[model samples]
Target: MRFGSIRVRLTAWYLMMLALGLGVFGVGSWFAMRASVFHAIEEELADRIRDVKTFLQDQTPFRSKIDIRDELSEHSVLGLGGDLFQICDEQGGWLYRSSALESGLVPIRLPSQVGDQPVYENLTVRGAPVRFATARVVIEGHPYTIQVAEPLEEFYEALERFGLMLWISVPLLLIGAGLGGYLISRRALKPVDLITTAAESISINNLADRLEVPKTSDELQRLSETLNRMLSRLDISVQKMSQLTADASHELRAPVSLIRTTAELAVHEARTNTEYHGDMMQILAEAERTSRLIDSLLLLARADAGEGGLQHELTDVSTSIREAMEQGWSLAAGKRIELTANLNSNPIVVRGDGEALRRLSFILIENAIKYTPEGGRVHVRLEGSHAVVTIEVTDSGIGIVESDQPHIFDRFWRADKVRSRSIGGAGLGLSIARWIVDQHHGSIEVQSQPGQGSTFTVKIPLAEIPAPLGQP
Candidate 1:
């Protein structure tokens, strides 16, 4: 048996407790037996003393030593074997001693002071143990002492036998009990063994596999359920990571291939200054696009790793919205789209990273401008209430279908793939926007209908305290 295993440890503990209990019981039983046996011996000796007193009182007149000896000799024969009795007068003269006492095999002593109560003693006579009781009696106005003794060999022998039985049976009982306990522990942990086996068999490729959950309604069942849930989370994360990798590869390929092709064409052919300049401009544009895609991917990677390091300083939501609209103004004007904002007179302060808030506003506004048709209107609104500040960006653009709304924010997902590519939108803008909102403990949602328009709303909790003066 492996001592480190729970089964062995459980069994060991059970046997240890059982052994302690049995030991206590054995010692208690031994003491109880000893007390009972000695009590019975003392009672017998007491009864013998009383019989001697009665015999002396019944023979009232004679009171001669001869009569007392004759009467006691006959009475002593009525006792069990190895019983002895001796009597003495108050003056220390021996009246009678039993043959067993006279034979010198048992030396019974008279107590120095005899009283109304009896005195009991244990003695070793001729290498055998004995119990003696002495008492004083007044017979016919004369004081006398009577002593009685009983051999303790039988009582000692009985105790020795009981002790031997305990010594022998206790070990045997413990052995059997330990075996049973080990078996019980093994059976109880069988489910744990199965769980271990199932878990070991699973790998990254089989993350969808789950452990068999037992219906025991115990810790084992709960453990299996928790492990299954963890596996499910891992499966989902892995699948998303795989999808992200594929999408990033696809998105990055276009810009990288264009730059490579442009460079090759410039190098292999002799061209005029104008052609060379045009080729260089095309390469730079592709490089810039690739750089932007890489930066976005890195930002998302940092976000997923919980290292985005967003600041928690008080920021003015209205100021960030105005900045975002100012940046998008040129693009909207170039497209002949009316870009406008409706901001409250007072600053809407919230606790968040100022730079990140500005970036979040820009991503939404830019996304709206990119998707909205030329001559369409894009409006930005910032409003604040007691608890939360809301930012709504409404665009009169090509709206999204209901079924595609849920996945619009997904990384690298685009409602109009061809339009997104033409507009240089790598589909990471909304994802990053969502992460920023989440960092500020806020929510963002979009309401859109096909052929109508789209409204993107962001709600962020207001700062607990007003921003200090000149601390935008």
Candidate 2:
């Protein structure tokens, strides 16, 4: 595996863990084995001391005072094989020394008091490991201290072999674990590599293709699913953006072509005043339409960029609605539609941009009048309660169908394309109105059915009423 790769890191971590576990196991085993070996040696030494005590006690009955050196020499064969033995009096002077300890004195200390428990120690004797035990006994009413020691050469040899085996096996185990772990990690991440390649190959033109979903329920599978979801959303957004661009181009081309053609026709010849005035008027009207369309587009763009500049202040929503109604009367009168308002006399105040609220009301009223046939009726109402204010604009117009109602607020979408085209709208009024309401933390709902009529209701929270002067 390459350095710093996941496979290598996994293998390295596995090896580290294995090494730690093996080291703990080896240390524990070594300590356990040493304890068992020493325990066995201790048992043997205790038994030998007991035998020596029994021999000494037997000799005590035969003689009131026995020679320690001679007695130990006669029964020295009864002691531990290839071991050292010594006897000392209470005064700390050696009474007897066996042949094994005669050549070099293996210093042994007796306990201050006699006890049933024997004292044990480990020492080095003649460059070899040894275990020593000291015990106290009473013989013929005389206190005697006995010292017994055994060589540990074979024990040391076994431990050394164990240590050597552990040293040799641990590295091999670590190497095997590393290789196994690398293989497992590589196998697990193989899907990740495939996902990366597939994702890299996908582009805007082929956003419809999705990554393969893995069957196993794991993080990798979830990642694949999440990425596919993101891709789907991006694809939808891109398609919407493309459609918006095409519609914008088509809409802009009309007014621009009209303006150019009208200007060209007016200057192409010395026309009469009436003709010139009509052409100029037509050009001006198209220019105003183009400008309004551009402004609406820019506003939507700003809203999309999260730069919706809304002023937060106390706004009298009823007044704005009345103003929009007054403006709508002219347009309605031109179309011979009945325009009316049912605004509450009490002020319905909200915290939002007054201009934006007026624009929102205008957009809804204009949309109502534009779609309404001649002699149709349009009504605007503003009502307020303790918590929220409601604005409803009802129109007797070509209502939207159930299927098309959901998309009416989408940019550049129209329920009746041919009628909308003849009606001279850029199909952005409802979208802009929706954005305005959203900025004011409000909701707009549409209730419509084909050939019936439409009611657009807007709800915004009511602002706090100011307090009256206090008598206190």
| Clash counts for the predictions, in order | 0, 0
In model 1, which range of ten residues has the least summed lDDT? 103-112
lDDT of each residue in 1-472, candidate 2, tens digit only: 4886777887888888889999999888988988899899999999888887887778767653347467677667654322488877777677778887877558656535656567888888778878888898888777888888888899989988988888899889888888888888999988888899999999999999999988779999999999999999989988877887788899999989999998998889889999999998988888888899999998987887789888999989988888888888899999999998888998878999888999999999999999888999999988898689999999999888889888989998887778786677888999999999999888999998767789999999988767778933
lDDT of 1 by residue, 1-472 (tens): 7899999999999999999999999999999999999999898888878877887888847667798677777767876222477877777777888876776554433434778688888888778888888888888888888888888999999999999999999999999999999999999899999999999999999999999999999999999999999999999988988898899999999999999988999999999999999999989988889999999999998998789989999888888888888899899999999998899979889999888998999998898888888999999998899699999999998888999999988999898888788889999999999999999999999999777789999999999995789999
Off by over 4 Å in 2: 2-4, 63-82, 89-97, 107-117, 311-314, 401-403, 449-452, 463-472
Question: TM-score of each candidate?
Answer: 0.91, 0.87
Measured by TM-score, the strongest candidate is: 1
lDDT of 2 at 153: 94
lDDT of 1 at 266: 91
As for candidate 1, its clashing pairs are none
Cα RMSD to native, each candidate? 3.3, 3.4
Question: For model 1, what is the alpha-carbon lDDT of residue 354?
Answer: 86
- Runs in model 1 lying further than 4 Å from the true structure: 61-63, 80-82, 104-112, 466-472
List clashing residue pairs in candidate 2: none
- The per-residue C-alpha lDDT of model 2 at residue 248 equals 88
For candidate 2, the C-alpha RMSD (Å) to the true structure equals: 3.4
